[model samples]
Target: MKKLSYLFIALFSLSLMTTSCREQKSTGEKVEEAVEDTGDAIEDAADDVSDEVEDAVDDNK
Candidate 1:
């Protein structure tokens, strides 16, 4: 009976560890996605500024 109880406890602990690892991986993916999105936004803003400058120069001509 004691051996059975120990086996149950070990299985439960292993399950919990697996779940924790999956959660950590999910969190890491979300952070990577956010960083990529931020980089895209910065690139778009730079393009807009470049276009405005070109337009102003053309107007002067």
Candidate 2:
């Protein structure tokens, strides 16, 4: 009976650990996606600023 209880507890603990790992993986993926989106937005803004600066320089010339 004691051995059976131990076996059950081990299985339960293993399942809980696996579930926690999966949750962490999903959260990590979301953070990675958000970072990528932020990078793209920054790049686009930089391009727009560059274009504006070029136009100003041309006008001055």
Model 1 is weakest, by summed lDDT over 10 consecutive residues, at 19-28
In the range 1-61, model 1's lDDT, one tens digit per residue, is: 9999999999999998887444345888999999999999999999999999999999999
How far off is model 1, as Cα RMSD?
8.7
* Cα error, candidate 1, residue 48 (Å): 0.4
Model 2 CA deviation exceeding 4 Å by range: 1-25
Residue 26: error of model 2 in Å? 0.9
Q: After superposition, how far is residue 15 of candidate 1 from its true place, in Å?
A: 26
lDDT of each: 0.92, 0.92
- Model 2, 1-61: lDDT tens per residue? 9999999999999998887443345888899999999999999999999999999999999
